[model samples]
Target chain A: SQTIHQWPATLVQPVGSPLSLECTVEGTSNPNLYWYRQAAGRGLQLLFYSVGIGQISSEVPQNLSASRPQDRQFILSSKKLLLSDSGFYLCAWSDYQETQYFGPGTRLLVL
Target chain B: QQQVKQSPQSLIVQKGGISIINCAYENTAFDYFPWYQQFPGKGPALLIAIRPDVSEKKEGRFTISFNKSAKQFSLHIMDSQPGDSATYFCAASTGSGGSNYKLTFGKGTLLTVNP
Candidate 1:
């Protein structure tokens, strides 16, 4: 019964603009959260993951940053967006070997 | 080091045919293997998964064949349909790390099924 939500479903921003994408999970508590970016026809690249509040592990070092202020709330942010930052962003939650359930995803377009 | 490697950057198959995608991993610690399906504009969804302890596991038209000794796993889609056309990803992870375990994914394979 666990569900994940992400927004804005789609985004368009000019280069160098600040960005913020939010993800939240319902029907589950204390689940591991992850942020992934996937380019068109490409595999997912793990950006960040958190096991609990205030515990963020970054998988890739880039212009983006992640924060876990609450147990089920995760935010992906960037001070200045780059053309390369545009892609499909996904938020997920998992427990043990159970499959990770992904949200609808955010399609970011940086012009 | 990249722990997992997936082959066939892309594949095309006709309806009712079979689609096969392969993946290999170097880390022996990986016990859980999973296959994910992604549409053009959607996040990857968990299609099926197999644990190293099981040689094979099936769910509907999708199956996962795992080879523990070879450190390899594969996804087989029988009776392929156009709706199955999408990007497929193979991922491996170990719960041995407990709460810190994170999935390590392969580059991915793109599958296209034509009617």
Candidate 2:
């Protein structure tokens, strides 16, 4: 069985502060990883996705960036956070473009 | 034409009643349709999915009905329970070998099953 883990389940940060959210999947290798943000009452918007290490694709232009430092590790980062950046961030993994499995998620609030 | 339109932004149903959510897409290239269920403050979970080749697919109490001609699909929950109260999102994807492996999702429907 594969499990996805995300940390700082909840985060509160002031404006212009740096942001870093981590996601990792255990029991799977070379899986497709994705970063999504869900605003209140809105559908998820894909921010970034990676097919392999050091390969990241941005779905939409924004302040956030993603990196696949390791095969199973993905990180979402921002040099400076904006008030609009506050939302529930989700990390998902899929095997061969199949069904996606999401993590618990990280609730980020930029005040 | 990548939008997936969903209807009934919110729904309220009583226990044991049936819950239905509809979604329509404009992209004919989309071959995979999936429905996801999300609890408050949580990531959406894959509930049921259907392929364009199938008219309907049922899993336990959940079912996905796909209309290839209309470019529409829907999810039906039979004998809905209080636990079924959550946000439901309908999504479509082109699957592998096209554009990118990203899903285009609906705005989501909030389902409340009153006990």
Model 1, span A1-111: residue lDDT tens: 888999999999999999999999999888899999988767888999999999989999999999988889999999999999999999999976557889999999999
Indicate the residue-level lDDT of A52 in model 2. 92
Which numbered prediction scores highest in lDDT against the true structure?
2
Estimate how well candidate 2 is docked, as a DockQ score: 0.66
* Tens-digit per-residue lDDT, A73-101, candidate 2: 99999999999999999999988656788
The sequence of per-residue lDDT tens digits that candidate 2 reaches over residues B30-93 is: 8888899999988899999888988999999999998999898999999999999999999988
Write one digit per residue (lDDT tens) for candidate 1, span B2-111. 57899888999999999999999988988788888888788888999888889999999999999899889999999999999988999988876576667888888889
Candidate 1 regions exceeding 4 Å error are: none
Q: Model 2: how large is the Cα RMSD against the reference?
A: 1.2
lDDT of each: 0.90, 0.93
Q: Which residue pairs clash in candidate 2?
A: none
> Per-residue lDDT for B79 in model 1?
98
The true-versus-predicted C-alpha distance at residue A64 of model 2, in Å, is 0.9
Question: What's the distance in Å from true for residue A2, model 1?
Answer: 0.7
Best by TM-score: 2
Q: Least lDDT summed over 10 consecutive residues: which range in candidate 2 chain B?
A: B93-102
Best by DockQ: 1
